[model samples]
Target chain A: MDVWNILEYCAWALAVLFGGHMLIDLARVDSTYDNDLLTSSREGEIELTQELHKL
Target chain B: MTLSSAEPTVQAQASTQGGERLQLLRVLGPGHVWALGVGIVLVGEYMGWNFAVGKGGMIAGLVACWLAGLLYTCVAMIDSEVTSTVAAAGGQYAQAKHIVGPLMAFNVGLFLVMAYTMLEAANAITIGFLLDTVAGLQGHSGLHQPPFIVLTVVFLAWLNYRGVLATLTFNLVITAIAFLAIILLFVSVQLGASHVPLDFSAISTDPLPYGWLGILAALHFGLWYYLGIEGTCQAAEEVRSPARSLPYGTMAGIMTLLIAATLTWYVCSGLIPWEYLGQAGTPLFDAARVTGSTPLMVLLFIGTIFSTLASANGCINDASRAWFSMGRDRYLPSWFGAVHPKYRTPYRSIVFLVPIALIFALGAPLDQVVTFSILSGLLGYTFMTFNMVMFRRKWPLGTIKRGYVHPFHPFPAILLLLICAATYFAVFLGYGSQLIAMMCFYILASLWFHFWRYRFVRRGDQFTMPWPRPQGC
Candidate 1:
């Protein structure tokens, strides 16, 4: 195979490599963690705790 | 190559399970924010703005550049005030969610994702085309471009997956080089160091082939000059201090784009005639070639490639943040919200968007991809005009703290609206069907949002910021 063809194969291989790594990591995280925990965030958490700091 | 994950710069000790966290790393400063904003936009100065020159001749192109500059200056002003107060990663989406309502925010978030992703698609396609051009010059015209397109998305997504600091720092370096390249070309042309002297009379010759209509037509393409400066706000949540960083970075970025755009137009128009400049794929590089100077040509070539890469890198960063923010609020599936335990990024969102970008990059025509991106951004800017008016009405200055306040309040908003209306007409003149198609696409997405996705959104919880009872409410 020529260099251009080899380069295309390398790109495909890297896409699979990085893309596969991400999928595996995503599955690992999804399977290992609870659904609620993975989905949970404090985006709108009201600052009830910070009230004491207000002078 | 093994990637090392980032350590938390600011610890969130809220979760006992050591897992659930809402925030990405707040490691970026104004410099990185500047990089992210400028990086996404500098690519246009290299290639796309010439279309404006083509549309209306040289003088018309200049007028459109200044008018769009005014439009974006208004955009930066409105975004600064709203984003400083909101202090969220999704930028305009978070502002709409809080000020307007859930439905508007959902659409805005979708706009952000689509705009940045399509721009990413455009950039990746450019890289492939750029490589193909290089291959052609080297007597090997048979280079397969799909691999390079695939390679661009994969590599940049991988970088974004690692951390925000490194990704943006990399953006900062390359963006600065690209910006410098424009300055170098300007200096070289002016000093008569280029192969040919600049022709001042090009501006006077055939200045407006289509009369006043050409200026209106140029407005649509003129957006390429400073299209993505408002994207600075997307880095808000990741900044060390959102209020300070967002406004400062955003303003600095707009100024940089302004000077860069003007210089680019001046240099390229002097070197190449408008008819040729308007349609040339790589106008700056072509300008370099006109001088017949190999070093300058090489410099412009490197600049184009760097600018394209920086844009794609910035797009991956912004698009993932928008998707992650939407997911975190359950505006979409919350599964996409998960930050990596080791790297402290929205890894799922970053990884997820790679294939979506790849689909468009591999499939669509470049102009189609770019048109969609520009229209999406235009829609977002139109939303900001209302967003600014409502923010002032609801909070009325003293009710809540803002890092920066735009002056001459209603003037910028009114001007912005007028400019937006004019540009809409401009787009309609050329791409009436595409404009209609885009509107229909948004309408369908909105319907889906109302019928299906609205149930998942935490409508009440989105109003988490501390504020007095909104004035009218």
Candidate 2:
């Protein structure tokens, strides 16, 4: 194979390795606690119920 | 100033600080953010491809930077007018959610987060690149290796994790040293100019020499220098007087940075050739190094480190605010909006932000990430400019308080829209590998996150940039 083809193979190999690493990183999401995501609000912020009611 | 009369001011401070506690030192003045802008601009110049363009390119790029500044100026004006009417927190996400429906606002907020995350990573990678370049010169060949990038990413993540006040104080010192370094370079160049002949031929050429194509390309990079101009508007509520200070601070920061950057480019261009700048790996540092002054070279290195650190710190502060606003609106999750009891900062959201930022910084190449940064930032500005026009019609002129207004009404506004649209289309066409890859990554992640947010993980209510109204039918 030509240099271009060989380089293409190398690029593909790197892509797969990196892509797998990213996926595995995502897979390791810490779900042990319900309070993990930055989504939860305090006990009584006014806008909470108001925004919910709009939905 | 009677001590007894000071009671009310103290009481007001006590209530505001005690009740609506936010990140300490977040309500920074325009001067601080302007310093941040300087750091960002110097970094942009470091990556700038002036050598490739030659004298003509340098002139073209500076003009483009001015135009990009104009676009930022317009957005800041619109934001100032809107800020006075609402007493709520959350910067662009809040304003957009209020004006537009929540769905559209949600998209913008998500895009904003993506923009910051990508940029944080991009900046980290750039810092790593500079470090590697410097190291390679010191005879270390493995400078481009992953370990270096990973280490820089970890360092930045640690700084961010220390909370807002620590970051801000640290940034203040970094920015101060950076400011001193840049000034020293300017002074040194001026003093040494007697040895070199001055050149003004770079600017005396035909304006728009490359026609619309060159103008568009320059504007694309120009937008890069003006990225954080509107950061103040996002942090308006945090400031002491949002009504007065927000408008003044936002505009002043953009203009000051523009002037400083223009002066730096002009002086540096005169002292050192554009060809040399473009060819050198770290052009700005190379400029100082070529001067043959060891003290000056050391100063520039210190300045670069300061610039990179301050930029990263400022970005983390601004980025987390976007998430905090979204969380409060119930779009992301309530936990994002949480303030640390003692520090009164967005500790949880910032915690989530730094790692994502590090991941991008560690993985991506500098140029790829910079292109994506410009793309995402311009997209945000374009929408904001368009939002202003729509806002003029939707909300009466009277509703927008007395503050800064664009010099020309629809003309400048229309021009902004066209420029923004053209740039967005150019990037989407996949000009660079990293831009194309990151755009795809962001779009896919946004879609996935949206489905998860609205479908399964959504809590009580969803928030958007331009907030949607209740269904009545």
Candidate 3:
């Protein structure tokens, strides 16, 4: 294989690895809207307001 | 600043004031935010950055991408800091208002709206171009029909107004498909033996076709690869935990784009001659054609369509939110802030932006559309970095509970500002007419804000910075 071929192989490998890592991370996270953060509307607003003040 | 401690005080204050609340549904998480960020710029990796190669050849293009990547990395880090801290739906506009003042906020907000709307229009035009090319209508002058562009704008805007959850879900699915298509393209090229091997020796002689000047000229196309990642930051309020999700999602999105950009440049350039690849409108599709696989070309074309639609969808969501934020603050008509009662989305703002985008999409050339988007986007970026520096000065370390503090404080912000300014100048020199047109738009926006919008804002106590002021400031 030529140098360019080897480089292409490495690039593909890295791309797969990065894509895999991102997908795994996405899968592992709790992305549902059922948390206290989203369900309790009034409380969530207050919490966000407080967070803004802290900044 | 303990979460438990601060909650009671805020609740007590809220009880006393009893004000109308924001109607935006909080259904997004890191996944959605990441998807939005990736979706906004994913189309660039598929097509636009090849223009960099036309200007500076392959080597210069790669160098430009690397440099632009560094600048965007800094911008993303600072974005995480500000978005997490403020956690506002308005994104940079809110940050600007709190850090600088109302005028800067107005400019940033308008610039963001312009940037995203222009990007949406550009994507719509690209879809038209891609479809024409796929149908063997490449030489057909009548392919860019205005009705088709208007239809695309209307469809995406309707999708955006449906609901936040539905819009984000659609974005996530299309973004995933686009990424997969890119991987498939890379694999197809690697496995196929139809193309000539990349000539590294040619880099020394042929890559610098326009000498050093070409590298500078290529900066804006290089930037196209990562331009809209900050749009993800606009989802801060909708994100489940802005403090956590904003930083992680946006930074992760940037990393993904960096990898995608590098792979797209390397694999595609390796598959075809850089000179020819640079001038092609649909470089990835052409690269697939080089593999001599008709099926691969079809697959890549579908991917192109999905990527463009995903970008337009994400831009519609982002631009509407920005307009809603301005309207809610009374910067524009209060009509823009009205949420759909059933869907709990900013239907008015979404609908308002559609015709504006359609008009631009129908009237402007594709290259001009993209340039306008980039110019406005760079202006917003410069202001955002400026806001970051001011934010750091206003709230020193330990003054606030920062979810993700960028390590260098003001340095990253300063570096980003310089990079944005330099790229803006480069783009102005390279594309003077578009920049001049953008300047005229900016001047008109400023006049409207100062003369009309400012008066409306002054007439009410409704406009207030969401963040607490620094002591004695």
Candidate 4:
């Protein structure tokens, strides 16, 4: 109805989009990745081997 | 230095190189570390620290600043040393895990999660309130706060979910802008560029309006000046060189906050009366308005927005890292431990915490939320003193290769403990009931962990760092 209302609607649209994407991604990863690997004490040590980009 | 000796650290290294198991990207450097630490804290300089002036007076605020500054100096020194060695995502929680035991680490993890999450909620609500204030000034009333609040959380969560480097780089830019605004305001006032008359006489004449007891009360608010600076250590795992980057960035972060906090106090104390300043919502923005300079007013307005956004963003980063670390160790569901295949971010932890932050931002009482966050931080700092003492006794000097060895260890540990005890009294003086309530909550959580969650934790495997067994062991 008004500019403030329009802004509020736009925010709602963005929140739903972002929040929804996160949830769907969560489900996809849970389905795809091995549970043992996910819960392991180890993580990928790619940076330990070589120099990465600086600041 | 030998990655081969660290079973899990080495396994982690091998898996990422050989396999497709996603992990957090390691692209950050010292600048990102400084940005993460300072971005979470500079928001306090914008508004919260002036509450000390309200508690006692201008002089009491100054005293609290120095005393808290001393406390955090000890924190920065000890944290840099421990974090460099731990070199993990969880920061203090990792230290708690290695130096103490499972129970302490679990509680420390909860402390990190609760502290950062509540602060995130506080920041989101502040953004809402700040925009609402502006709208009211513009003759628009009844502006809804939830849309803005939710937008802030979700947008920042999205930024965090995408990548760590971009999120922190964004934090660095905005945090620098906010810090510069404080410097500009301070220099302009000091140079008499602002014709607004300021009285320095009240600072001396009525320095202690409420006497010595007021100084004790002010210590609690004094924490606002340098709160969360040690959070730089949370980026330890992501940084290129933990030894070099962690210490350098964290020390630089504390130095920056000390300068920013003092300038903020000096500017506002001289510009506004202590009576009103203690209660001002956006004190720096208020100070700019008092100058009758529109350009200055607009700059401060932008600074407030940037600081609030940066704080919320940093909170998301720290909280998710702590949560993801816990999940990996089976402290929570391993489900939350998954790194996104594409983004290399801890997507689940970041996403899950968003709703929790939204709830508090939307419905919780402001004072209760802030008090809980502050108490959690105090408990974490108290844990740190013991951590440092135990770290030295268990490992001793020269036993481990620390990135930055903190000199005069027993002194810093002792000083930190004493300051923590005094600050607890300050909390009790005003927030006695809330303090008790928070203790009960932590106790209940600890009991739950001991009885139920300990079963899931990999006791020996949690010690993933490659170090010689402790001297006492």
Candidate 5:
């Protein structure tokens, strides 16, 4: 319950959390490989960026 | 000059999206966008005055939040129109480049990256700060250490590289957690408190607190919390009906933020005394503890973690895309344009942002980084307001279909322009040191890119409409 012990525990816990999330992201990269969003929200920005490239 | 009457050419251009695939799900609507805004506002409003100001502070803060939200609404409405027209991934930088020119656009991109970088750094430090409080780790500034902070930065960077859907899904889940935290805190306070002192009239105030100056200063701090409204524009192409969706989503987000923020502020403030909440290092955590519910405290801690992670992810996703968009135009190094061979996302740009963010998170003071974030966000908004005015005069109404025409014609637009001008000047007076230095640094960097790297290229007429025109001058 002391401050020092508490700090040590959190530092370790966050490090683990950060590491786990990175691995999960890397694993999921393969599925999102297409040149679009995983889920669409709006088409304007995506479409415009595409149009600019064509120009 | 008007565009060529050839509609076919424009269609052809729309089909090819900068040599990238058009793969995504059109799942989000105005409702979803509103939820995201609610999520951001709820979290943002919780901070700032909660710990520092207290009950009287909360009463004053809610009024302050609403006034600031109104200013944000004006800025976002203009942004929604621009975003609807473009259907592009990057937000401010893309808008600036199309309207202002490459040189100015480059400045927007540089400042945007720095601004979001500050956001990322703030989230990390805030998370660290939160953890220290919950775990009773008072002196732990582990985030200040470069190696530890770099790990956090790299983690989010990789997540961004994974692409947009993963980020959005994460956003949804984290939002749930954030809301749950609020619910738990509210319940704990009511059930556990033998004496409940409730103030129903807390949110509504006459003439508003601090008057115009109070509102202005609140807007300044308000800018800090509601800063990322435009980030949604980065995902415009992914949304189904951006013309309808952009404005609707933005409005929804703002309303949700308002409601969530009001509830969180009032309930949490009632649970604990203002003096304690204001000065307490981890005010939310302290509030949970005071409710005498260990389970609720644990849930809040987990929820805060989720909130921080989601925020960092959202910030990085938008910031890196700005870099990628600029690179695609060959404004910055082409390396930024490199898409992951597999992920098909702006992997390189996303990766590059991590180190820069880490440098700031690990190296700078927390308050200094936060001030830089506000400066960058305001500077970008100032450019956006100007762009809205110029877009109206330069382009014919018939040419661009999706943009929101300023109601009451140019008068309202001009009023907004003046407001932006005054606010930008006031920001200089308020956070003058951090604001000036960060703006100067980016301005110089932009000039270096323009004169040195892109000197030989003939500058295109930036104000020209995207549609083609006749050659006879």
Candidate 6:
């Protein structure tokens, strides 16, 4: 094979490897949580007060 | 001032902080962070790198991208360290404040905000152009209407104001679709019976069309491929286990970008003559059209739109966060720091940024806007890398609980600093006017800091680092 052919295949191989790694890394992440932190206005306000005091 | 009146000011400050706290929800995971990182620059891999090909042909363009990728790799490694260790909302700006000081942080914050906002505006205009072309709205009187740009920014800002989860979910889906589209394009090129074998020998002798100088000239376009991957670190405050997620997300994001960029350059250049492909605004779409398949062209067009949406959406998310961080630090007005009571997102900052981005989207040419963004971005990178060197001196290894550390201790930081310096100079030479504009912006930020903020702003103590701790027992 010529240089172009070699480089093309190498690019494809690298893409597969990297894509797989990214997927696996993403798969390991857990996103399950309650929306209370986002939705509860009172709780959010209280948390903000505490955070400001800490600062 | 009397103590009673001072009490009201303190109460107002507390209320402001409370509202700001309600804005950013801490729920993003490694996946969302990775998606944001990839989404922010996916459009560049799809379209902008072709300019590098125009400057230096295929080989030289590839070389420039390789150098840029190396620089980004070093940047990602060191940035992961700082982002994870600091675990703040401002990303590089926060790192600058902690490692250097607030004055430097102000400059870096403004540069970052400008770079991301400009990038967002560029994507908005590109989307309008794509829609115009796809719908055959060209050659019409209202080809580039400001209303369309305004509507697009408003829609995206509304999504941002809704919540971080909604924004990131949209980013994840669009980025995934875009990635698949690129892979599909690569597959079609490989398996199509009518595939034209690329004539590498045709341009072998004169790959450096403008000679070695073309390589340096191509640096800014080359940077387009992997420019905003560091943005994932900006979402550090919202991430769970930032010490772990920030490094993993950033590394994964860079690796993905590097691979996508290589495949893009290899496939698109091979499918068509580099000279023709280099000048086309939508090179990949044109390459698909050359295949003589209507469906392939339509698919790639849709892919381009998805990539554009992902970029603009990610930019809004990042830019608003940077603005909010500055507001929280009193670097900008406290009004910029306000969050939506119900949605828990930085609605005020998002609303404030939309018109600024829309104006640029409607007014500026693509090349100039892009150059301005890259110039400001490189300035921020230079500052962050220098700050990394100082951070290592202050913290050292084993001194603190670091999730990840760039091995070889300072070499990577030093190398990244040198690369940033060289690229900054190249950019300054290439776009002198933009550099001047950036310098003026920096000066304006300095004046704001010294004249107004330094005198009136009461900074919190969260950012104060305690060094040289008293000896145990």
Ranking according to TM-score, highest score first: 1, 4, 3, 6, 5, 2
Return the TM-score for each candidate structure.
0.95, 0.75, 0.84, 0.94, 0.77, 0.83
DockQ per model, Cα: 0.41, 0.07, 0.05, 0.32, 0.13, 0.03
Query: Model 4 over residues B1-473: C-alpha lDDT tens digits?
Result: 34422333455546655763545666788999999999999999887888888898888999999999999999999998888778888889888988999899999999999999999998998998998898788777888889889989999999999888899999999999999999999888877767688777887788799999889899998998888887887887677778789999999999999999888888898888889999999999999988888888999999999999999999999999999989888889888887765566778899889989988999898777888888899999999998998999998877767777899978999999999999999999989999998899999999999999899877788886766687777
Off by over 4 Å in 2: A1-55, B1-27, B33-42, B49-56, B84-89, B143-161, B193-212, B400-407, B425-452, B455-473
**Which has the higher TM-score value, candidate number 4 or candidate number 6?**
4
lDDT of 5 by residue, B1-473 (tens): 01211232242244344442333334455545554444444455445435224322545555545655666777767777777666565667767877776777888887777777788887777765665454444453432333345555667676666655566666767866777787667766666552445444433533233344544454455454476766777655445566677777777776656565556666766666644554555556666666666677677777677766776777787787787766666677654554444344666677667767877787788768777877777777778767877766555466556545545555545555666665565566557776667767876887787779676433653323355331221
- For model 2, residues B10-48, the per-residue Cα lDDT tens digits are 433454444532222234555554554444444555445
Which residue pairs in model 6 clash with each other?
A: B23-B344
lDDT digits (tens) for residues B1-473 of candidate 1 = 00111345324333425554545666888999899999999999987888988988899899999999999999998888888778777888889988988889999998899999999999998888888888788777778899788888998998898888899999999999999999998888878877677775866767689899999999998999888888888886677767788889989999999999999988888889778898999999999999888889999999999999999999999999899988888888888888775567888899889989999999999889888999999999899999889989988887676778899999999999999999999888888899999999999999998999888876577886776778887
Poorest stretch of ten by lDDT in candidate 6 chain B: B1-10
The DockQ assigned to candidate 3 is 0.05
State the lDDT of candidate 4 residue by residue for A1-55, as single tens digits. 6677788899899989988887787788778656665544363243344322222
Per-residue alpha-carbon lDDT of model 3 for B364-415, expressed as tens digits? 8888888888998888888877687678788777776778888877788878
Model 3, residue B473: C-alpha shift (Å): 2.1
Scoring model 1 with DockQ, what do you get? 0.41
Scored by TM-score, the top model is 1
Worst 10-residue lDDT window for candidate 3 chain B reads B1-10
lDDT of candidate 2 at residue B97, scale 0 to 100: 59
User: Residue B380 in model 6: shift from native, Å?
Assistant: 1.1
Ranking by lDDT: 4, 1, 3, 6, 5, 2
